[model samples]
Target: MAHPERDTDSAAGTGGDPGSWPARQAPGARDLAGLDARICRCRACPRLVEWREEAARTKRRAFADWDYWARPVPGFGPPDAAMAIVGLAPAAHGANRTGRMFTGDRSGDFLYAALYAVGLASQPTATHRGDGLELRGVRITAPVHCAPPANRPTPGERDTCRPWLARELTLLRPTLRSVVVLGAFGWQAVLPALAAAGWRVPRPRPVFAHGARTTLRAADGGAPLGLFGCYHVSQQNTFTGRLTPDMLAEVLRGAAEAAGLPVAHAD
Candidate 1:
């Protein structure tokens, strides 16, 4: 498979002033591919840049032979997706290593498994970007693109990264009909992006809860967007009974149906 990261480095340098790239580049992106290319090169947050690069250099023992991506991971899936899955951020050794959201991690294992079971993903596992995993009508993304220290990004960092999410939503506005926000962080972060992208978020902002559901009308009077909240597929939730296979499938199936996509019976 072609290693696109090698080419991305040179392009990133020419963009100028890493801290200002998102605000400057995001709105002007002509399409999803252009936006993703811009997202992959961001180095806006000094702390996150240092942390992601350090993790790549230190090299986790299990992946010692890997050429770590060590860059901001962009959203994965087709451009004209009807459903969107929003997560908090990439894992240090997961997406940070493979350069694909949810790849090389247990969280991805759980997520892809559920997606496959629901007939969205082409396969049940995502080991790398070139592994041939594909989503039929759904797109997966996150609030923060870089892996933060201890898997937590500061509020300032989240705000700084808001333009990317907002731009991504704007690009997907034509077909994006339903969203499954994983965890409270993603829920909190995505609401404003949705509003900024043309959806009219309800007053008294919606609270996050497992199985929580709401609808946001479009400012352009387009199709309404359905928002569903689900627990993060982190080990903490999956290892315990907090989030089960059936629970995840239920939410995904509902979202898929809401997006007017075909749903397969859960396995």
Candidate 2:
């Protein structure tokens, strides 16, 4: 189903300039909705722009009948979320097709099921943008918004996309008190963004591990933020038993509690 919230048609256009739109517009966004709109309209990275459009044009056979979102997948969840879940990037046949982060893919299946088990999600499935799935006290976003070729975004692309994540962190700073990063890539990518968003990262950056935890002090003497690391929900981890349902649920429950949200005990 085509997401009514996305402008897939006009998404291909550069909106007056290709490589300079994000830095020029991201900071000026006063609200999450405005930031999301600007994010979806960005065409700052030529390589990512071409790859996402190609995937949309010659889509997977299973979704040939479906219209791919083909644009930058915006962060999903309420603006006042107390916790944020950071991931690597959008999956090509997943969010790149369904227009919602972590939707239409097995990775999403694992992540959402864990969230539901921990009492943080409204549903255990997320197949599309309109699937009635909602996250409580948490938001999901990525370092790179567009789907990259071969599931690996170059270092240049990652740096170019930093402004969007930095701006998102700024918007969520009011209520965000905890973060769960789902891989080393997202961990490294998010630390700098967190510092840029007004949190003072420790001098020696914390290392990434399945159960690593760190505390960041707010630069302006506001509330402290807890950062947790977990294995990515990619098939490589879940299928190999490197990350299990029980394990994921435990981490999410811990993070939710750290954010001051009431978490139900998993059965």
Best model number under lDDT: 1
lDDT scores of the candidates, listed in order: 0.91, 0.90
Against the correct fold, how does model 2 do in TM-score? 0.94
| Model 1 lDDT, residue 104, Cα | 95
**lDDT (10s digit) by residue, model 2, range 1-267:** 222344323443455556767776778777788789878878888999889999999999999998999999999999999999999999889999999999999999999999988889999999998789989999999999999999999888888889899999999999999999999999999999999999999978999999899999999999999999999999999999999998898889889999998887955
Q: How close to the true structure is residue 17 of candidate 1, measured as C-alpha lDDT?
A: 68
| Per-model TM against the reference | 0.94, 0.94
lDDT of 1 at 57: 97
Model 1, range 1-267, lDDT digits (tens) per residue? 222323323455356666666777788777888888888878889999999999999988999999999999999999999999999999999999999999999999999999999999999999997889999999999999999999999998898899999999999999999999999999999999999999999889999999999999999899999999999999999999899989999999999999999989943
Of candidate 2, the 10-residue stretch with the lowest lDDT total is: 1-10
lDDT of 2: 0.90
Regions more than 4 Å wrong, model 2: 1-17
